[model samples]
Target: MTTPVLNTVLVRCSHTYQDELTVGDTKLLLDTTFRPEWHRKISAEVVAVPRKLNTRHTAYRGLKLGEIKAGDTIYFHYFGLTKENRLDTEDQDLYAIPYHEIFCKVREGVISALNGWALVEPVEVKSGSAWIGTDSEKISTQEGILRFIGHPKTDQPALNVQAGDRVVFSKNADFINTIEDKDYFIMQQEDLLATQPQKANEIESDYAGPRHYYETSPFYLSPDHD
Candidate 1:
């Protein structure tokens, strides 16, 4: 295998899923298995690294992934899934991705947000069926409960808020990921506007009213297909 150079890191993608295929004239329906969005592979093992840095690649100097070493399992961006980035070989599923595209190391048994990124669990409301941001046009009140906080990096500084803090972040942030069928957003720590520690009484829970005792919240969808 050829070593990547000039801040380009080589990696073999973990695994992604698709249920349908179109070849020639047939539309094939594959397995009916429903894999949650998190199960979709986004982390990959670093196969090779550049020997020398490029003068123009400032991001390669102090990488958030820290040294961008080989054998590191890191989460990266989609890179638009361009054919130019992928090598369609007979056996190798290799991708030559720029070092900047690699986000952070895959924290074992946990989700790790690195380089000033925060993993946020959207505050559930309306009987725990709807999300806080889903209905509110008001950005001030929109909030998320932090699940994991990233470590400080060279250019990416750590957030003042810790895990479990309720935070209202700026509208400039946008990125939502589904883990175990639940939604979480990964936004830059600098985007946070205000923060507060989680309170017991103010703890977000399934909203319950007298009517909820007899019926489900309108946002709910039963596992049974209707």
Candidate 2:
């Protein structure tokens, strides 16, 4: 006899896909994956926030950090567009699946914007360099191109960069042999999940010149006289 697993949340499947699925769908996916009988309990809430513009296709907007407190209960599903090619005996056609499956929480909701974060900076290449794109399109120089790194976005899949992989950027810089490629930019830094240091003390650049010490101070009176 299959022992009935006890759970307080009930999840249902929804045919339609929405940024925020119904609460019912949330419970169903949880039941299948997060075996409540054997795993520790985890929960959170879904709160909406401003969406970032020009993000990846799968990256939806309106998700904020701290949407759910540490112990609040919540459920979710994957929401986005997908493409699939298939050849079959019954029918020959491509199957594009826009699916939403329920998912239960086994840990804290730490992936929210408030809890989750990112840092973006222009790519850096020297004034002159030679490089090639994963597409084999040779970049001769760096001019109208920008390179950066952060949480993997849906855009620019050719980057093939991982959490620690170096991100390189290149554009069509030449039309002849030994294309005249210039270094545009590079986000050679590691994953920026937290605050980024604008200036480091060890290596000082002109960009980090000493301040006048009055950027935020008003005219000061003489020390001897008020």
Clashes of each: 0, 17
- Alpha-carbon RMSD to native, per candidate: 8.3, 21.3
lDDT scores for all predictions?
0.58, 0.24
Compared to the true structure, candidate 1 yields what TM-score? 0.62
Give the per-residue lDDT digits (tens) of candidate 2, residues 1-226.
Answer: 1111221122222222222212333421222233322222112222221122222333332222223222333333222111121213232221211111112222342222111222122222322354223222333332212222333322222233333222232332111110012111222222222322232221111122112222235753323443
Q: Give the total clashing residue pairs for model 1.
A: 0
Candidate number with greatest lDDT: 1
RMSD of 2: 21.3
lDDT of 2 at 120: 21
Tens-place lDDT per residue, model 1, 13-66, is 634433454545566554525433323455567778777656356665445434
List where candidate 2 sits over 4 angstroms from the true fold.
1-158, 163-226
Error (Å) of candidate 2 at residue 48 is 9.0
Q: How much is the lDDT of residue 172 in candidate 2?
A: 29
